[model samples]
Target: MAQIPSPYWPKGVPRALCLPQVPLTHYLQVAAERFPNKPAVIFCGSTLSYAALLARVEALAGYLTQRLGVQHGDRVLLMSQNCPQYMAAYYGIMRAGAVVVPVNAMCTREEIRYYMQDSGARVAMVAQELLPQVMPLLQSGEGDALQAVLVHAYSEGLPAQPASDEVPDVVLAPRQWADAPGLHGLEDAIAQALPAPADHPGSHDLCVLPYTSGTTGHPKGCMHTHATVLASNMASQVWRGLHMDSVFLAVAPLFHMLGMQGGLNVPVTLGATVVMMPRWHAAAAARLIEHHRVSTWAAPPAMLIDFFSNPAASERDLSSLTVLSGGGAAMPETVANLLQTRFGIAYNEAYGMTETASFLLGNPLARGKRQCLGVVTPGVDARIVDPQTLRELPVGEVGELVARGAQLMRGYWRNEQANQSSFFELDGQTFFRTGDLASVDEEGYFFMRDRLKRMVNVSGFKVWPAEVENTLYEHPAVHEACIIAVPDAKRGENVMALLVLKPDFKGQVSEQDIIDWSRERMAVYKTPRIVRFMDSLPKSGTGKILWRQLQEQEHARLATSPAQEIP
Candidate 1:
């Protein structure tokens, strides 16, 4: 069934868009041709013009193909914080007719090993600071398919003299390149300036494989082709009325879908300027916004909260901002109202997953609902369906939010079981199950009710409980662990663990011990902020832990007690 036209749809915006048919790199190529002297990326104090950026991209592409032995359709790992090098390497890998597998810069050695093994990526581009994590895998010969690592220093994108005191110390730190057998410096590779191989990837070719974790405890790659990614990029540009002149604040982490689209892909495709932030600092972000006259900012709720909370932000000239939007966790109603009342900027919340290439739904610029998921985006068909029966539900009835669109991933890479469970056909159209409980209002605005997946939203990061639980079980003191979401005054939700310790280590181990151990094993967001001792966990007849029960109990306990700050 066709969705009813939304009465709140923005004027002059079409319900559907005619997306470009070429590969994603085509846009960067065209942008360079049209705007050779224009600034493409602004990092710290240094800037890279479109002509200069394209030269670096093509050089890296040439080195990857000619020297690194990268081949068409081969997956290459890219692990780095947001920088000009990240952009160069990202497009370079694709320009080489290979797949770009983005790994979180914060990922532990073991986590990166899993990505390397799973993706069978032989080549990797990593930051100088993060090279230690990948070195062991290469030296030990444990990274079976991983052959070489290309290291980039953050300082490569920084100017000789300080651009501003706002530049983080980490970015200003001098390069400390390690001496390893397979480790190569990115500067050396680009200096070769080898001719790029012929472009072969088409619109339908695989371009990126960004991973998303599930109940399985392992991250699964979402296979996104050029066309699939372009869908969301084009849709976002058109829906948000973004133009070549628009200046964007690229503070969001580019590895994630949200940041990849809003921070990098969208702006580059439009021939716009993007001011990059290697790491989030409210004061630095504010100064950058003021200095560059940033017009659009794609910030998650936590960043927005931090920005507004900073006293320095108020002193900055911020009237240049025209658009403020993002979604990972819902924006607190208070924060939303504050933004509107103080800055006259509406907080436009969007909805998407890695499988959707970042954009699926968004509030119209002119008319938006507070704390709502907005409407189905251009060319997207979203429906609330009864998860068990696969029957479409009526408006206002909470059910699983499933969508079919050009932006959806081809499927989970090499995981037939996950692909089978994640997508289904309804009325001859394939729809990807979002695993989120939502309902649409009479005006066609969708509201989030709950999540069907066993996942916790820490600020904007998705922490799968099962994945965290598996890591916790690795601790010697832990016999069994159940991870659950608990209310957080600041982060919206935080991970909490209920652990059953071993008989001998029960009295000797402390909650802090487990937390400290977990920090080394998993990402910081996945580490439990609160740990509780449980003699035994509530379980089903099948012996599966009843996590939902404990989650409800935790919420009830917090409701009656004075809210405490989450450490």
Candidate 2:
């Protein structure tokens, strides 16, 4: 298997060879040293210079090491939205030689508990609003190993607020937030903290633990070492043409791989300015970009659609944008065309997951393509393999997309069975199975056809139906549950649930009632868009629901009906 060059490669771009075997923290240290006064993070109308950002990172790293007793290789959960605190704590954990485990702030208590137990995290840095969820875990004795919790308050850093009308009034009003037993304010800890002892980790030292949902019915931790994750960081920087001068818009949540790489990690690596927004508000985002003259923005299709649809879009000066890349879902062809023809902005699309740090395939920055995951990146060997036979498929034949890259995760943490099932050795290279049904063109560009994994793509968010089904089962009325993907013109696919109620509760609950119940128990994207009552769900002889049959039936129904708009 020879390495194939991408025909879509930007003319000036050189195929990436080996990245410098630098620790992930090395990026920030280098940037701060070279340009101490340069702005490393822009948040809430305030700028954290390289010197200031590094100082905060050093402080937090010191606090974790000295006060919290976070030793090398220890997993520290970071539960927060996209904000300055997320950035400081993220790199700080790695700087102290501890692993960073980022959990979605939107996660319910049950979901948070699972992540805490699975990762065996001993400490956490959480956003102020989310402290309520993370607090219960620490108090429950179930999290005995967890010693401390650091709270990141966005209200402290936000230049001004009422960021939007939906923001809670309590959240907007100020008060004296402080430290208590097992709880510490991040700001207070940083003030008294010291720079951690110089600890240079090996290329293989695990630095990040991001959980990804798998076929095994739960989210499994993806162990990424400094060296492995660095590959994607550096490659993304070069591939997207980021420089010290680039200003990034940080709208994507930092917990996700794409945002962690493009919005935070890459900027630190290049000493670029990252304008951080704690939440996604189209108007606020547009204003920040115009005010800061942002050069790069990494986002999903949903954000793009919303940002463009904003009436303020007509007034914003987005001419400073030079790079816009996204993954999780492809930008619709018409939308991409409109962007290029009307705004002169080339949307650089990429494909990656929690497994690959963030990149494995990406559309070239120069000759960008719509709806195509670009050619295999430098130092990556991607192939379309028959899902059943595990044999390579010819160009244009759809199959599971498997890839081996420098940034690939070491393996799913503590899940040997999943590790065995997800990775296979082919041509002497160990490739991670993407679970995506796709095809590669003769030019080496890959196009997605479908997902072999039971996951739905809602506005570029991966929603595991099994996880949703598990949550739905918690409802008292649900006797049996089957979650399936329904055709959604805007979301690409949305979750639709089939439920068999307890005989006594048959007419007790409404479809809207079940939908509301499920929403509170799981992530919003995982909530069912449509809930249908069923006397009994179609099942296999083994007692498993026949998900595929139902999925196909829904496709037929949708095919015959006129599609509805998302709004």
Against the reference, the lDDT scores of all candidates come to 0.85, 0.80
lDDT of 1: 0.85
lDDT of 2 at 195: 74
- The segments of candidate 1 whose C-alpha lies over 4 angstroms from its true place after superposition are 142-145, 454-567
Worst 10 residues of 2 by lDDT: 162-171
Model 2 spans with C-alpha error above 4 angstroms: 1-4, 143-145, 158-179, 454-567
Clashing pairs in 1: none
List, residue by residue over 1-567, the lDDT tens digit for candidate 2.
Answer: 554567667766657666787787888889999999988887665677888888999999999899889899989999887777789999889988889998887788889888878888879998777877877787877635467898867766655754445443434545344556799888888999687768766668999999875555899899999888888887777677678888888877788887888778888888888888767778888888888898888887646855775778778998988888887655655567668887899888888988999878888777766677888877788898899999998888878989998899999999998999999999888889989888888788888765676668899997756456656656767766778888786778888998888777988899999888877778888888888898877742212367778888888987998876643
Per-residue accuracy of model 1 over 306-384 as CA lDDT, tens digit each = 6886887789999999988887656666667778888787888898889999899999988888777889888999999
Q: Candidate 2 lDDT (Cα, whole model)?
A: 0.80
| lDDT of model 2 at position 260 | 87
lDDT of 1 at 486: 90
